[model samples]
Target: MIGAGMGAMAAAARLAVAGRRVTVYERTETHGGALRRHERDGFGFDTGPGLLHLPAVWRDLFVKTGREPLEERVAMAQVEPAVRHVFADGSSVALPGGSRAGTVEALDAALGPGAGERWSELLVRAREVWDATRRPLLEEPLTGAVDRAALGRDPYPARRRGLLRRRPATLTGVARAELRDPRLVALLESHALAHGLDPRRAPASAVVLAYLEHTFGTWYVRGGMRALADAVYERCLERGVEFRFGTAVSRVVVEGGRAVGVELADGTREAADAVVWGAGGPVPAAGDAGEAGGGTGAAAGRLTVLLALRGRRPEGTAHRTVVHTAGPGGTTRTVTVLRPGDPALVPDGEHESAVLSVAVPPHRAGAGRPADRAEAMDWTAGEWAAVDWTAPGAAERCADEALAVADAAGLGLGGRLLWREVRTPADTERETGAPGGAVPAPVLAGADGAFLRAANRTATAGLYRVGGWAHPGGGTAHAGMSGAMAAGLIVEGDDWRGSR
Candidate 1:
């Protein structure tokens, strides 16, 4: 394994249990890739994902790898009123978790009569899309030649309106045609944006993203999401998987048209029969062999602000809140505020820790230059200077914008905040080695398969891909599934379809 990310570690554990000696070489001194935690004083915050959806992925991992189940490894519970949405129009609604009827009732009560029914009807269609693609997209590993022609077609059953037989093809189109209300549209679009997707370009099948959360329910593990990462790392150790941290793999050693080992950054070569490329960016020796043919489209990264507050967390507070604001050019922007009531996160009962996050364009050298100047610059300029996140307080400014939105939604953190830490895409890049900190979005079927990640089985024989950068794409659940699929392909042969 090339990295000790959640997906890589998951694969390492399983492969070890299958009687294969597994070794992971991580560039950083940590195990989790993006699943990192930040601490100050006695306060800790999850800088990566704040919540876990579709935990069955991890449950299956534990069940298969050991006698102990996932629940025994970590403390987790469903977040009630899964999310509270505060729209720009000053209307708010708290949707109950895992209960379709409850969600409908809450929407009707808050957004007026019939609104809940409309939302429920859309979810019904989302279920259809999920059922159609769940197997091919999530459970099975993508073949060398993916059936793009079939999978490229949107599975979302958009209802036809008027005399014309036209149906919405994109997520934004569905929001306008079916959702109707602006607030409802914002609600739907927020899900896409949160996953680094643009609703205008995302396929209608992306509705399944919301469906998965609603059906599986949102959950938070005690001591932040990093605890889940720690559990997986511990599992790998228990399975006899070896991990070498602070070590980078410079290239995969290829011979006779097959990947036989990896060359370390220190000029040391480690031989192996098979290699799993789970790190971000690019596979060293694959030569674009595993890249998605049509590309996965433009991806965005996250800007997170960790706030330490002096006041006690109010009782009955929703675990998550999404504050929607109108962006430039009529676009909608959202900042998600997370205030888990876990005691392990705060210094004491009198203090609280919260996380605020928003999606932004991935970092690029000179990408932040003034638009007019950028248009005038030479196309082949040499080594443009790196984006100065600190100059003029760029990260702080972005965090302020997000905090303002959250405050306007009634969070009122300004008066209680003790200190704040801003994390930008540059920080993410430094930590995970993902270029520009571009977080990969989950693979969706549509737009001629433009959003799909590369297949697990690469053109280089004996070299496989796992993690968010590969098929099935990002999200904790998807990453775990990627590991299982890669393990199955290696142990059971390429003929293995998936779990039956």
Candidate 2:
């Protein structure tokens, strides 16, 4: 394995159990690619993903590798009232999880009558899309022989209203056609935006994202998300997977057009029968040189602010709250407030630790090196770079913005803030080696196939890509799926359909 990201470790555990002497080389000193934690005093914060949706992916990993189930390894709790959506129209809805009827009721209560019905109707459509693409687009690996055309075909059906036959291909289009209300439109588009995708271009199939969250529900590890990664790492060790930390893979050693081993930065060479490339390691800093190259259209970056408050969390608070704003140009600006359900995250019973994440565009050409100089003057470009959270003093500005958004949603911190820490995409790049700290978006079904991800099987024999950057694309669950698909291909051969 090239890197010790979740996908790499998941695959390592499976391959080791298959009687292969699995060896994982991680560039970082610690395990868990983006699933990192930050601690100060007694407070803890999950820097990467706060919640795990569709945890069945990891559950399947544990079941296949050992007798112990996932629950045995990590304690997880379903987040009640899955999310609180605060829209620009001053209307808010607290949507319940796992129950379609419950969600409909909440929407009806908050957004007025018939609102719930319309939202529920949209979810029904989403379910169809999910059923159509789940097997081929997600469970199976994307190989040369696979029918990529089928994956590109949109499964969402067109809408019919009187004489109008509206066939909206994108999520934004669906929002405009079916959900005429701006708040409801924002609610729908927020799902796509949260994934670092532009809803205007994202396929209508993107509706499945909201469906999956509401259906499977959101879950959080007891201690932190890092605990989930630790569980996977422990599972790998139990299967006898060897791991080398603080080691950089200079290159994948190729002989006869096949990867036979890897060359480390220290001039050490380790041979292997097959190579799994998990690009979770850190990339080069600023002008520093590195083996990894930069790529365009990497998923948008996240700006996170960790708040250490002096007050305790009030009772009946939503686990997650989304504050939505619109820019002068009408683009949505979202800031997600995460109040971990676990009490262990705070320093004491009298205090609370909250995390705020805002999706920002990737610094594709780095600061000042514009991809299009004229585009910078455009509203989108300015809106994208409005918060360079990595810049000095920008953290304070973003924290203020988050607190303001929270306050507007009636989540007032008042003077309880003790301290704050900010993390930017640059910080992520340094940690995970993803250029500009870009977060990879999940692949979507679209007409031009512009959103398709790279195939797991590369041109080089014995070499494969696995992780958020590969087939099925980003998100904790998707990464786990990529690992499973890659491992399946190696263990079951190229003709492998998928894991049963």
Candidate 3:
């Protein structure tokens, strides 16, 4: 295995349990690819994902690979009022976790009469999309030739509106036609935006994104999301998986049209029966199998601002809040504020740690030329090549913009902030080695299969792909599922379908 990311580690543990020796070579000195934690003055923050949804993916990993279940390995709880939305009109709504009836009631009470019914009706359609694609997209590994035309057809049931009877094809269209209200439209679009997707281009099937969270509920680990990564790493060790940190694999060693091993950056080669490439970025020795590319455009990264405040966290504060504001060119931008109730994240009850995040163009280190020298460069040509996040005050300026939005949403942290740390896509690139720190969005079915990812089984016989950039797509839960699918394909043969 290459890279000790959450997905890689999950695969390593499962492969080891199946009587296969596993070794992970990670470029970084530490484990956990993006699931990083920053600490200062006893205050810690999760720099990666702040919450977990569809945790059953991780639960199954623990149940299959070891005697201990996921709950026994980590302390976690369902976040009540899973998410709070503060819209541009100063109206707000808090949706309860895992309760459809409660969510409908809360939306009605907060957004006024009949508003909840419109949103609920949309979710009912979302459920159909989820049921149709859940097996092919999440559970099974993409093998052989994929039926792009079939999968590309949007499964989201369209709403019939006037005498013309037109069908909405994009997420934004669905929000406008079905949701109707601007605030409800923002609510629907926020889910896609949070994943670095532009709702304008995203498929109507993207409605499943909201459906998953509402049905599965949101959860937080006690010691930040890093704790979940640590648990997975520990599990790998217990299963006899060897990890070699600070060891970078330059490329996969191909022998007789098959991957036989990997060559390290220092010219050392390690042989293996099969290789799992979990590291993001380009796949090495992919050959012809790598040609199938669909979801590689408009990939954006996240900018997170960790705020340490001097005041106590107000009781009953929602765990997560999203504030929507208008952006340049009539676009809507979302700034999400995460305030987990876990005490381990802060110094004490009197102090609180919060994370404010917004999606932005990924960092671009301007090729070989200095960033300052590339001032006249075109922004649209190279993905993330135009934004110089390392430029002085760039990250701070973005953080300030996000903070202003939070303030308008009544976060009330102006006088209580102690210190803040700004994490940009540049930092994400240095940490994860992904070009431009571009985080991969989850795969959705539509737009002629433009949102699909490369298959886990590559043309190189012994080589396989696993992680956010591969098959099942991105997200903490999807990455875990990616690992399981890869491991199953290796142990049970290519004919193996999926978990029975």
Candidate 4:
């Protein structure tokens, strides 16, 4: 394996369970890419997958491996306020990711009279789209030559039943055709862009995002997500998977278009029959400046964050904040805040929920280019030793933006003291080797770029990739499923299940 992030680990776990000797080569010490556990000043937080959704996916992993999952160690509680949206009027609404009836009711109260009925109708429409797109587009890989004729014939059934049309060609058109409320449309489409693709112009299949959230539901893990990672790491050991820390991969060594092994930065190479690109570093962009010597376009916007909370969380009464600050330079700043406790996310806890966050549209560093996956995480133990976790002013401008979001949510922090930390997108990519500082395939764009994400599969043979950086994008579940899917392809050679 070239990277031991979530995808790699899940893949390794699969191969190892099948009585295979799998040596994972990770450039950094950590295993889970975006799903890493950071501990500073006795406080531990899961910097990735802060919110859990699409549960059946993980349940499927445990069933596939016959090995218990880390889920046993952690409990999941549906986020009561699945998401709290506050506008400039100081008016706020909590959008719980469940129940058409309740959500419809909430919509009626928040939007207008018939909005509740509209919500139900939209849910029905979303379900129709999900039933058609889930398998063909999301389950199967979209790679090889773009044979428009052959690709369009896929079973994802982009063609709806008379009344509607399912098309992967355009995003905005689909939205215009289906949703009437601009706010509702924004809510439906925002889920797609979470992964990095601009949803407005993406594709119709991306609508699966809204469908999945509403259909499957969303939740927060009790006692933090770190416990889950540690548990998985421990379980992998029970299955006899060996892990080495503090080592970095120099390159994925390929011979004659075949991946034979990985080269470590320290100049060591390990041989293996198959290699998976779990840690596919930044998918290079078009015109990033900092990327000249950094390798690719994806390297320009690398960013990661670590928000260490000081004093107390918003007193019992919760407040959620998601802020979008359009910088003068055009770069956008985003700060997400989750209040401490809700039976769904955090349990009756001793510590307040470490407000989770991320900033999109990072400042472009330089210009060099490639148009591939955006970024990946490279974790090193030594690097973790050097950071100043106590400083909150690291991204002063971003911090101020976060505060503004709190005020917008009608939250008042009585100014107490404890801890504060910030990591720019550059900081995250540098710390974790997440190329472009991209959030692990957290949001898989639909609409237009869905086909392009199939790049998760490498150009070389015997090399497979899993993790947030892969095609389907990020999610502990997506990473885990992707890893297993690739391992299945390798184990069965031509007979593997789930292989496209």
Candidate 5:
């Protein structure tokens, strides 16, 4: 494995169990890729995803690879009232976990009469889309020639009585036609936006994203999401997988158009029968992968603010609160305040740890650069570690803006400041090796298959791609699923159907 990311580690553990001598070479001296943790003054914070959804994806991996299930290794609990949405209209809605009816009731109570019914109806359609595409798009490895007609056809049903000539094909369309209320529309769009997607352009299949979270429920690891990564890493170690941290892979060593090994930064080469691109570090020039062109555009970046407060989290506070900031037309700017259900995140009972994550647009497009994906920012290795977030007080200013938005949304943070730390896209790029520090969005079914990701089976016979940048696309669960598919392809050969 080229990198020890979540997907790479998942595949490594399975391959190790399958009797393959798996070795992971990570540039960083850590196991988890984006599932990172930061600690200061006894306060720990997850720099990556705050929570996990559709945890069955990981549970299945643990059960298949070992006797002990995932829960045995890491503590996890469902977050009740999963997320509180504070819309632009000043009204808020706290939606309960894992209950469609409860969500409907909450929506109706907050939005208005019949609002619940509209959302419930939308869920019915979303469930249908989920059932249709969950198999081919997710469970199986994408083929060289994807069935554009099948996957492109949006599964979300259109309203019968909508003021339109035909059914809406995009998420924004569905929100406008079915959810007339702007608050409901904002709620629906927030799901896509949270995943670094533009709801206006995202296909209706994106509805599945919302359905998955609401239906399966959001969960928090006992310590942090990083704990889950630690558990997976431990499982891999038990399976005898060798991990070489602080090792940088310069390129995949290819011979006769097939990846035969990887060349390390130190000029040493280790040969392998197969190579997996687990940590999509840098795009190799053509390689044997036939130019590697089909991959989706550059990804959006996450801007997170970490807060260390002197006060305690008040009783009965929502675990997660989203305060939608006012922005230009069609732009979704949300400041998600995450108060982990796990108390271990805080320094003590009196202190609190709150994280604010804002999905910011990518840097402006450079001259001659594709407008869709921009790699305008220039960064070098080790720059992220010494990033001057305090230069001109940008970090503090951003934190104040987030806090102000939160206060406007009825969640006040007045006079509770101790200090704050900010992580930008440049930091993400340096840490994860993602191009342009862009965080890729999960692949969705849409017209022209525009949302399709690069095939796991590249042109190179032995080289394969996995992780958020690969087929089935981004999101924690999807990344893990990509690993399962990659391992299945390697173990079962090209004819492998998938893991049932």
Candidate 6:
């Protein structure tokens, strides 16, 4: 397969279960793609995606893989205040758990009277769309052909008469369809930003996002995320899947419009019935000379960061300082801070660092020489360059950010700093072949990009897709589900395609 990312792992497990002799090629020594882990001394850190929300996807995958049932590895925990929104106006409110009633109540209290009612109406409407598309889009078998299995269930629903009446459109459309609260609208639209997607461009069908998270609830893996990846890898070995870690696949061996095998960088060609592009493309680095060539292991100009922090995070808003450069004038820098989890990365709890990530500013697409002075001022880079967690400067940076949030949210960070770490975008991209160092695969929102993503069916035949890069979207939510659907397509045949 192409990359042994999350989607590729899911697909490989499913393919193996269906009795296919799958051969997966992963460039990294570990599995789990973004969910991979790293360590220094005794401190360990989860590289990407801490919160495991929308977990029905995993449950479903376990059934197909015939492993120790999803419940054995991960259990569902319903946490309240799904997230705490801190506003610069010093106005902050914690949104309750993913429930229609709970959300409305919280909105009403936080926003105003009748605000809850409006939020309820919007979600209720979204719930309907969720029902209509859940089985068809999320669960139903893949057709392996260009067909709308969803539209098949209702060929004559007669609801397509008007554009406004169609189901699963966009976030804005859904808000207009039911909600009047701008705050409520922003709350629902948060998912787009969470994935680094532009909401204005994402489709109304994206409304399904809010519905899915609310109804399904969020979860945390019982252990760290790596355990889950190891489980899947173990399953693959049982099913006889071979892998070549650290050995990059230079290119897909394509001929006569079919991908028969792959050629490793050292000039090794391995043939197979089909090759699944599970591994991500080449590493993204600054000034990558060969990146422009556009092939396997050649992608450049992007990066992701991972930080390992140890010691107890300040309690009750002890963590602070996640910001995004704003407006047309600001650079594209996103900084996120998360408290170490209850399950520490090390035997002693003093090993986890509050994780922070900053994407390396890309060189101007058509610029000459190196980045100019103006570009440097406008673009943002990783915070680690400026702050040292183990040094004296970390205290200043942490306190500065904490105080910023205090002024913004009216919430005080009461504890002293213990430990810290920072990751540059370039570091992540170089290690993992993620383009632009994008995580959770930058949500392919908006009309223009609706078709820009990689499809389950590539230009080649027999090859299939699964994982974060699949349709419906990314995250643990889509990865496991996409794998299941791809498996169904391979096993059931493509006779039912093109109906929609």
Instruction: Write down the lDDT of every candidate, Cα atoms only.
Output: 0.84, 0.79, 0.84, 0.54, 0.78, 0.52
Where in model 5 is the C-alpha error above 4 Å? 161-165, 281-298, 330-332, 363-396
Candidate 2: tens digits of C-alpha lDDT, residues 70-132: 999899999998899999867889988898888878988998888889988998999998888
Question: Model 3, 55-150: lDDT tens per residue?
Answer: 999999999998678999998899988999998889899889888788889988988888889989899999999999999899998876555567
Q: Model 5 over residues 56-100: C-alpha lDDT tens digits?
A: 999989988996788989988999889999998788999999888
Q: Which is better, 1 or 6, measured by TM-score?
A: 1
Candidate 4 per-residue lDDT over residues 1-500, each given as its tens digit = 65667667777777888888877665566766666555666665555557677766656556566656646656767766567655434444566667777887787788777867865775675676666555544565435555223434322235474797655454444555566665555555456544544544445555666677777777666756655566566656777888877777766666776777777778777887876766545322112221111122221222333444444455445344554333222222334565645333332344444554543433324522112111111111111112221233334444445554555555553143245555555555655576546454443333223333444455566766666656455667776667767777788773343644
TM-score of each: 0.95, 0.92, 0.94, 0.78, 0.92, 0.74
After superposition, which runs of candidate 2 have C-alpha atoms over 4 Å from their true positions? 161-166, 280-298, 364-366, 369-390
Q: Name the weakest run of 10 consecutive residues (lDDT summed) in model 1.
A: 373-382
Cα lDDT for residue 295, candidate 1: 30
Total clashing pairs in model 5: 0
Model 3 stretches astray by more than 4 angstroms: 161-165, 286-296, 367-386
Give the poorly placed runs of model 4, Cα more than 4 Å off.
40-42, 67-70, 146-178, 282-335, 342-353, 356-358, 363-394, 414-419, 440-451, 455-457, 495-500
Q: Tell how far residue 253 is off in model 5, in angstroms.
A: 1.5
Give me the overall lDDT of model 6: 0.52
Cα miss at 401, model 5 (Å)?
2.1
Overall local distance difference test of candidate 4:
0.54
Looking at model 2, report the run of 10 residues with the lowest lDDT sum. 370-379
With candidate 5 superimposed using the best TM-score fit, by how many Å does residue 486's alpha carbon deviate from the native?
Answer: 0.6
